[model samples]
Target: MPDWNLVGKQHVLAAIAECDRLGSRDFLQRYRFGRARASTVWHRGQEYDSKAILGVAYLHATGRAATADDFTRGEAGAVDLLQGLGFDVVVDEEALAAEKAPRVRKTTATKPARASRSAPAAKPRRTTAKSDERVKVCPTCYMALPATGICDNCD
Candidate 1:
């Protein structure tokens, strides 16, 4: 079976669980009914937008749509599918954070090698601008001229 990330799987399961709890038939229907009848759904006194809930439901449903692979062959609902197949879907926030954290490479400090006394110190090279280049300037206005050398405001 293919390995799945816990964070993604958890989000899918949460969406499915919410859908089941609300007795929603499908994602589209739920969204339409919520929009037309009730604009929002309250959970634990906190009001959540119906569209947001339906959006999450749709994502979970579509995410588990592909069953051609061996990992999710018989799965239907995101939550039921994983649970029915005996897949341990545990979401550890700390582990997920650790996984997302940038990896730092460890290295031992080394002493710098001394420069050879025989070789003379190299002088820094100075860069000089070429004086032969021609730059057109507007005669009417003392401003830098374009390719046509025509002043926009004066000419």
Candidate 2:
């Protein structure tokens, strides 16, 4: 582990100056750094990333940049280090929740309930064999005629 004792307020200030001069994206790239997720350092009414600033400050102190794995992060880490230097380091609840929580779904319209039982169906009519015997067949025309023995086809 690199000596944390070497990091001073001047180094942190220089890192902040470098970040503002080069902009966050370029400054981070120059130092091989990423955005701080846990805590952000607030100075001169501007919010700076905690991890990058501290890591870059460590570089400013020793001329060699410290990676994320170089030191611990929260209580006894960057926060503690920055706090020792009298920097306002705030751990935003929103940032922590955003990193850990899943995506939220908006409430949608409720669907209509389905019927439990179906509608009553109509019953089919039944035909009997005795009703079929009542029909008379014509003799000459060979057609089923009325029971009066008169053939409509023959007439």
Candidate 3:
């Protein structure tokens, strides 16, 4: 009984079918667009660009986004209208919730020496600014190597 508005005619039909298959009038609700930003809707953790929505619709309808660019603003408007029809669109919130679920696993116990060996070797400890004065002199010409770890003028 909701007021369907901006979506495409075919998109409306598909959302309706999805709603029926999912056994929830709210299925289409998962695809709500904001009043202020008609071009965006939630998808996973990000805002799905309007183009992506068409891409999604294309994928849903034809297994690919072959003609996604063909989805016009009017079509997007039609989709908005269909959402107004009481479809239970998920709006990315559920998707994010599912991702945040706690996962359990076994903990590893390693000897300090073994763990240290597995750990990446600590990067050579950086010397402080005070240490710059103590740079190693080149054996050939006594020229100092800039902290660059190399003597550019020498080799």
Q: Which structure among the candidates has the greatest lDDT?
A: 2
Would you list the C-alpha lDDT of every candidate in the order shown? 0.40, 0.72, 0.39
lDDT of 2 by residue, 51-89 (tens): 788877876676566766676533237878999999999
Worst 10 residues of 1 by lDDT: 65-74
Number of backbone collisions per candidate = 0, 0, 26
Judging by TM-score against the true structure, name the best candidate. 2
lDDT of 3 by residue, 21-117 (tens): 4433233223332221234343334333333343334334433222222434333443443355433233344433453466587899975676444
lDDT of 3: 0.39
Q: Better model by lDDT, 2 or 3? A: 2
| Candidate 1 clashing pairs, residues 3+ apart or interchain | none
What's model 2's overall lDDT? Answer: 0.72
**CA lDDT, candidate 1, residue 10:** 44
Supply candidate 3's per-residue lDDT for 49: 39
What are the models' TM-scores? Answer: 0.20, 0.57, 0.24
Off by over 4 Å in 3: 1-38, 43-45, 66-68, 78-155
The deviation in Å at residue 10 for candidate 2 is 0.6
